[model samples]
Target chain A: MMREIDADKVAETISGLLQEGCYRLSDDVIHALKLAHEREESPPARHVLGKLLENAEVAARDKVPLCQDTGMAVVFLELGQDVHIVGGDLYKAVQEGTRRATTQGYLRKSVVDRPFSARINTEDNTPAVVHTTIVPGEKLKITALSKGFGSENMSKIAMLPPAKGRSGVIDFVVACVDEAGANPCPPVIVGVGIGGTVEKCMLLAKEALLRRVGDPHPDAEIAELESEILKRINDLGIGAMGYGGRITALAVHVEVFPTHIASLPVAVNLQCHSVRHREAVL
Target chain B: MKNNMPIARAITLPLSDEVLKTLHTGDELLLTGVMYVGRDAAHKRMIETLEAGEALPVDLKGQVIYFMGPTPARPGKAVGSAGPTSSYRMDTYSPRLIAAGLKGMIGKGMRSGVVKKSMKKYKAVYLGAIGGAGALISRSIKKVDVVAYEDLGTEALRRIEVRDFPVTVVNDIYGGDLYQEGRSQYRIADLRR
Candidate 1:
């Protein structure tokens, strides 16, 4: 017998998560920022980090958004194979949840109907970037991230020849950060996706950002790569808000997937220090 | 311990040449007075209006423009969480505004080379407000009014009066860029023994 999960319940859970996620900075992110603040040698960098931490506190205390952008809603769902959703369409439920969350939370409506030509506001911030995967369980897991476009616009990808290898990946990622400079709001958290097809690699890069800051990849070799890439990036001296400082990046999270023998696809997804995300299991 | 103290300077808007000359890269500032808001959509329209040989919605002479699109204000709040957007998107429009007597810009990120050149040529400065510190920054914004292009929603032009709003000098009239100066000061190669 399959477990029957009401779509409304999922919607409600997601709505609550969205409100909380937008208002509250996660502990790991807060911790990493505080650590960065302590370690930062530049006075301006330290001052900016101090203000960011204070901003997080004000948003949490006042029940307001951490940043005005509030961002386009990106939802990651793990649907259980044994669970049957009832009462409504799952996607529609998610949209409904997002609509209520934005209205109730006072989040910004950032989505537009078309990229070019029309450029009409969607108003409710609907049609979230939903990525759903099937898993073997009865529970549905959802993660909601408020992805601000300031950093989103800075994200990039490239296909390197296989022979370039690790050094190639490091150089490309660092170069991306160097080019981004202050635009993406430095003291940035870098997410790297290595291998996989073009699209899959980009997704992997974004998904890597969901990991807690300072948490190393489970694989030792990949973890070392994360550290190396991070060191090179901070070495660029972009610092806080590109004002220059010792701490340009808070952490680098890398996620890898198997790819074609001929392809070494890499993607760099940058996240601002705000780093708003929340998850719920229904 | 000695380097930890930031050099704080207070400035009033509608910036004069004296103020512009005093500003240098890396100086922290708290700004007070009235400023106008505009973003990409408004900028495009402003340029179109300029091309038509018509006046802008607001006179930009001797004024500052903040690159931002704010969240809607709830009841009892002056404005919603207002913060700076990236500055590069406004690069094309900024030179024209600078030529029209715009003296300063507030936003996060680096300016394009063309925009920086215009700043130096026209005696302007670019200040950086904390990118993600919307709520904190909003406290300093005491008044707000929609001045133009209301249909643009958040992208609409706003006339705002701010008090002690925090910012840092990113680019100054002397052709100094804080982004380059800051990076070079702490680059790993410079720090390595």
Candidate 2:
């Protein structure tokens, strides 16, 4: 049996969260940008970085959007088995909340009706990408990660042979980022999903990005490997915005999922310096 | 040495090969005067026009082209949140522009092979603006007019005049790449031990 919660309350909360998240860059993200600016070496890259810092400062001061691509809102929900979502529909509540936020939040309505023709703005940012999973708890936990297309476009999934092992995974990810170079905006957060099916790997990689920066991997051996890989990625000298530097990657996160004995699917999700995400539980 | 240069008022100046050559990798520029705005769509059209041996909508002789797709302006604004889009997408179309007297590019990121080759050969410079800084950048623009491709909406071509628009020289006339130069200076050899 699930206990019911007020739908209007949930909608209000979701709407506020969406607007706040879209309008402001997270503190962690701001800190990372500052750190990147301090560490950047190339004069040109540093100049550009200073501008980015100034932009963030101005945006924050003015209460304006940090980036034009407010991004497609992606909500990860963990529904409590004991809690019932009441009053109207859950998806509609979320969509309406997003719509309200997009309009009032002053976010750009990026979603279009059709892919090819009659491409028109959805007016309000509706139809947010929602992923829900049932959990054992009594609380409904929601996490949102706003993603822009530039960094998202650089995501990669590779079906590597099991024999190639971990080194191969590192190679593939580094190669992808290298090819992506300055395009994805370097000083990136790399999330690696290993040992899952192709689609699962992709999802897992994105999920891994939600992890805190600089947290060590739980598995000791894997932690050591991750450290080594991070060192190498930074060594690629992709730097800030691909201006060559030692801090190309701020952190590398790896998540593993069960896979077929013969297959190892690896996915790399590169997040830019502006990784905007927030979470709340109710 | 750069610290000595006084921060001046933002002003819009015309785009020309001469004005372009005066810029170096770390120079701060407030661009105005005459320049065409284009991105992927406009590039395709420009290339098609070139192939057809037809004159482009805007003359290319000694012009600088900005790579940007801006948000729709608020009521009665010249443009809205206009910022540079990615430059790499225009890599294939750049050499032609340089040959057609396109002397400068404004955008972020790196270009490869022929684009770099063309910049060096044609004496053009690639200026880098901060990515994700659209709102701040838009403040510098005082005027904008649609020159072509209105159907493309944000991706349409426009002529914009900006005052004290900030940019860093990423690719220089001598073939210097600032992106490569910046990272090698700060990357640590090892993180553990």
Candidate 3:
């Protein structure tokens, strides 16, 4: 049975999700931060964490953005195979949704055109980066991530030789965090993707961020890897707001996929404490 | 539990020469009074205007520049969610501005060696706003108005009035750097070897 969804409704749903996502942070991240506050030893680190908690409260109550960067709108769509859209094209509707979110919600329009020359602002913040995957269900799921560039700018990817093996992956991930230092807003959530093609691995890293902060991966080995990486990251002492402390990472999320025998690719995506993402089903 | 921590010193801006010398990296501050806001795009334009031998849009002497661009103001509010962006992107343009008598900068992230040298030479300090705490920071911003480059939208240069704006000194004229000091103090000996 085809589930006919009105495109206008899709736009409205997306707009609503983006607004709520920017204003109120999800419960999981907030909970993780609370845990992080207790774990930190440095006074400055603890102080910064307290301020972040307060900021989260202020953002929700006032309906103001959590960050001024407001970030590029990265939309993820899980479309049911049996769904049919009426009245508007899917991608166009997504763009319309972002436009409405920017203008109506008073969100910052951060998109621009022409990178090489004449970087003109796309004032409407249109053309959300829509990633669609067809699924078995008759219902569609929409997610919006307000991807702040401060952390996005620090993300790194590498195509490692298979011989470099497990230690190399661990080393690479750890070093990335160390080098990112105070830049990507420390006490960050580290997302790791292993064993796939380069682009696929990068995508997986971003997908890993959707997991609740510090939730273990289903695979026991991967879960162990996540814990080990988290331990080492905190040892770097790039604490809350990079003021240095015992909890540099609130969590480490690792996702892995099978790959060709000769290839081992890895990607790291860092999510600053802002960590804004929201989703709705329709 | 909070007894050991130093209280944040309140500052009224248009920072005077005497005030500049007293600030140290890691000292918490709550800023009041006015500052100008700019970022990558606005800084580039100001440098361009100056390079062309044209008059600059706003005065720099004894002024602070915040590396920020805010969300649109809500109903009856001056601005929305004003927070600092990364400062490194402004590194290329900062020395020139500092040389022009700018007193301070507010933003997050570490700055460049050149920018640090310029700060030492020009007697300027770098302050860091809490990254990702825009809504909390916005509460302190009482008013905002675009003073130049309105076409740039959020990146437009603006003059703002603030009360108890929160910041920590990351770089000071006396060669203190909080990021460096903070990291070393807490870094545990490598447990992985």
Candidate 4:
């Protein structure tokens, strides 16, 4: 017999996650920042990192957002095939959760109605960028991430010919960070997605960031690549807030998928040190 | 060689040429006094108003403009998390504002070459605030009022009074750029050599 879960429960869980994600820096991310601060050689970069740590502490204590750009909510849902959602439309329920969280949490309403023409504020930060997948278990997993555009604006995607392979991927990812320079805010967390189709590659890259900081991919080869890419990025000397330092990037997370023989799509997604994300299961 | 330890300076707004000349790229500053808040939309509207030969909402003569769009304040708070936005978006309009006697700007990221040249030409300074440190930064703001374009919501023009608001000199009137100088200092190529 399949299990039934109340949509209200999901909504409430999402609301809490949204509020928590914005106010608190995840433990792993905080740890990474502290490590970066200690390792940073540039005094300015060290000072900036110290300020960021202090800011996080203030936001947590005061129950306020860590940054003014509380960011667009990006929700990742993993639903079980055996579970049935009851009492409300799934999408509407999630949107309502986001609305409630933004309002009750006193977070900023940053969503605009139209891209180019009308350009009106949505007021409640609604219509979250939601990605859903169906899986085997009876439990539903939800991860909420507040993605600030400063780093999102710096993301890049390129479809490389298969022959270019690993070197091509390395060069592209490094160049993206170099070009981004100070704009995305550093020390940054880089998410690299390799293989898959173009859109899938981009999603993979974003999802890669959901991994806890300092955790490496299970695959040895991929983990090695992650370390290499991370070292190269830090070597760029973009530093904290681009003030220059030894530790520009705290970590580089990579996600891979099988791809067609003709194509090797690579996407690089950068996250500022704020790195706000939280997860809940119901 | 520039010292690794950032030299701390205290500055007040409506900056003077003598004060501007003394600032160097990479110096840390505790800024105090009033500043106008404006972003891309506000800049565009201001520029349009200028082209129409109409008076700007806020006078540009000897004042600092902070590039930010703050979150709405909670009931008891002066303002919500208010932090600097990227300044490059204002590249087109800034030179005109500098020409109109704007003395300083607070924002993150780099400015265009034209904007830098104009800052040097007009004796203006560009200050950088920590990008994601909004909540902490907001604590420095003691007062806020919507000066113009309330309809713009978060993008509305705001007049805010701050005390010891933290920032760093990213671009100075002497053609110095902290982003370039700082990064070049730690680049792997140079460090290896």
Candidate 5:
């Protein structure tokens, strides 16, 4: 059963998601923030969290950007095997969506054309980093994450020897957060990728973030690993915005994949307290 | 213990070295008056202009600069979601600006040792605004003007007037660092449970 979906619809949907993602934070983050506010023992970190809650409200109510960076738009597309696209090319449509959203949503044009020399703004925040996957359903899923570089820069990937095993992975992720300190903006949601080749490991770490905040993985062993990592990370006492307190991370999500017998690759992707993302099914 | 948290002071800009001497890391403040806003691109251009032996677009002497680039102002507003960005990216250019008599900076994150030394030598200060709280912070900005590098889009250099803007002293001229002091005060000794 093949369904023809218009490419314009994809663009329009993505544009809307980007605007909404920028204006208001998703509910999961809001809920976790409120919980952190209550659980936090330090007055300073608590106060900062309260202000962040107010910021979220103000942004949503007044339709203002939650953060100035607005970030590079990273979109994940899951195209159903049975769907056919009409009206335009798929990849071009995604870029068009990013461009329109940048203009209409008042997002900052943060993308640069060159990293090495004479770096220039792309002007429209176009050419979004798109990751596509072919899936078995009739519905296409598009998820957009506004990735701020403060945290993105702090993220790390390490190729570990298989002999080091689980504890090494745990230590690396925790050490990354410790070194990151307040720079990534605390109370960050950490995404961990383990057991794949390097690039796949990085992608898996990002994909792990798409899961609802604080939701443990389904597999019992994986879910336990998530809990263990979350505990160690929060134990750093980096606290909200690194003001230092009881809770530094709202959640830690981990995703795992089979890899070469000799390779053990792990990646960490940190999302700031303003974890702005949205998804649509078409 | 709570008394260590300094009461928020009302500060007017062009902060004198004598006044900066009294401030310490972790002191809260509400700032007023004009300040220039610059980010990665604007700072790069300003540094290039300086290195090229040309006068900067604005005189940094005895001035405060905010490391930020706000979103486009909504209709009728002065600016949109004006908040501090990470300051480390500007570290290389900061010491030179401090030497040029820049008095203060508003941004988040830690500063490199070189930048801290410059702050001490130049008698300047570094303040941290609450990161990711831009919407709440923007309400303090009362006026805005594109002072230079307008083509940089959001990274353009802008002159802004803020009233009762909230900030905290992250690095003081006396070598006190709030990020270090604050984090150390709360870091749990136990690495794991």
Candidate 6:
């Protein structure tokens, strides 16, 4: 028996999530900032953390956005094969929802028609970068990540040889952070994708960010590696805003998929302390 | 412990070496009075206008210019999420702006050698607001009026009067750079160890 999925419900969910995610900083992110504050040795870094925390609380209380860059809304959907979307074009519905979210939600309209030349705001943040996947059963999972461009511009992808192994992965990831320094904001959450194809690797890296902060990988070997990377990343001395401190990264999340025998594609997606993401099931 | 520092004292006064000495990396500032707003496009125009032996659209003396391309403000709002962009992009134009009597800049990230050298030579300073704290920062700006390049939309040059805007001192007239100084402290020598 196929389950019926209401399109209006989906649209409402999208609008609600977009507004909530844009305006309020998440608990995990705020907790990470607080932890960074306690661990930060440098006075400047500590002050920066305090300001970020205060800003988050004030923005939440005022029902205003935490950052001015409300960012392009990215939707990752996990649909149950047994569920059917009713009454409309799913793509159009999502776009309309995004539009409403932009105007009513007061999110910044960051989307432009083209990368160059006719660079004009689309007015409404439409045509969200929607990633849909089908799974068994009747439940639908939707995750919205409102990404700011400051950190997005600094994201990098590299394809490495199989020989680089785990050590090489750690080195590459740390080096990427070192080069980025304070640009992406320190105490960053590093999303690492290992062993997938080039494009898949990037997707996996970003998906890794959806994981709860400080959550370890299920695989013992992978979990151990995650711990190692987290330790080394924090040791990078690129404390809060590169002020130098005990903590540079709040967490290192690694997600892996089987890849071609000869390829070890790695992607590093850096999210600043203000990692604005939220999830809802409908 | 916080002090009840008045916002007026910080914003309207002419910035000098003596005034700058009191600030440090990570202090909250609520700048009021006046500041200029310009980005890549207006910067080029300013330089070209200056090279043509013409006066700049706005006087650069005793002022701060934020490097930003903000979203349009709401109906009654003065500005949208108006936070600083990366400072490195404006490194080239900054020296010229400083030479033209610019006293301060607000942005994020580390500046290049040339920008730092110019700040030292010109007795200017660069301040950093929380990169993503745009909403909170905008609350300080009481009024915003586009003084030049209205066609540039969000990137136009504006004369904004703020009340107690917040920022951290990144590069000062004494040639101090908090970004570099902060990074070296966390850099690990041997990953294996």
Best by lDDT: 1
Which docking category, incorrect, acceptable, medium or high, applies to candidate 3?
A: medium
Measured against the true structure, the TM-scores of the candidates, in listed sequence, are 0.98, 0.86, 0.98, 0.97, 0.97, 0.90
DockQ-derived CAPRI band for the predicted complex in model 4: medium
> Whose DockQ is greatest here?
1
| Residue A121, candidate 1: C-alpha displacement in angstroms | 0.8
> Could you give candidate 3's per-residue lDDT for residues A176-263 as a string of tens digits?
9999888898779999999788888999999998888878999999999999889888888778887768888999999999888888
Candidate 6 chain A minimal-lDDT segment of 10 residues: A114-123
Docking quality class, candidate 6:
acceptable
How would the candidate models be sorted by DockQ, starting from the highest? 1, 3, 4, 5, 6, 2
TM-score of chain B of 4: 0.95
For each candidate, what's the DockQ?
0.72, 0.42, 0.71, 0.69, 0.67, 0.46
List, in the given order, the native-contact fraction of each candidate: 0.82, 0.49, 0.79, 0.67, 0.65, 0.55
Model no. 6, DockQ: 0.46
Candidate 4 lDDT tens digits, A79-193 = 9999989999888888988998999989888899987988888999998999999999898999989899889999999999998888788888988999999998888899999
lDDT of 1 by residue, A7-56 (tens): 89988988898889888889998999999898988888888999999999
What TM-score quantifies how close candidate 5 is to the native fold? 0.97
Which of the two candidates, 2 or 5, achieves a greater lDDT against the reference?
5
* Model 3 stretches with alpha carbons more than 4 Å out: B1-3
* Predicted candidate 6 versus true structure: per-residue lDDT over B110-156, tens digit per residue: 78899888888888888887777777788888888899988766667
Displacement of residue B55 (Cα, Å) in model 3 is 2.5
Question: What residue pairs clash in candidate 4, if any at all?
Answer: none
Residue-wise lDDT of candidate 2 within B64-158, one digit each (tens)? 78888775555666665566667888999999988898878888787877999999998988887777787688787788899998876666788
Mark the 10 consecutive residues where model 5 chain A has the least summed lDDT. A237-246
Model 3, TM vs. native: 0.98
- The C-alpha RMSD in Å for every predicted model, in order, reads 1.7, 3.7, 1.5, 1.6, 1.4, 3.3
Cα lDDT for residue B176, candidate 3: 86
Candidate 6 whole-model C-alpha lDDT, 0 to 1: 0.79
- Grade the docking of candidate 5: medium
Look at candidate 1 and tell me the lDDT of residue A21.
84
Residue ranges of candidate 2 with Cα displaced over 4 Å: A6-12, A112-126, B1-12, B26-28, B32-35, B45-61, B72-80, B145-148, B180-193
In model 2 chain A, where is the ten-residue run with the lowest total lDDT? Answer: A40-49
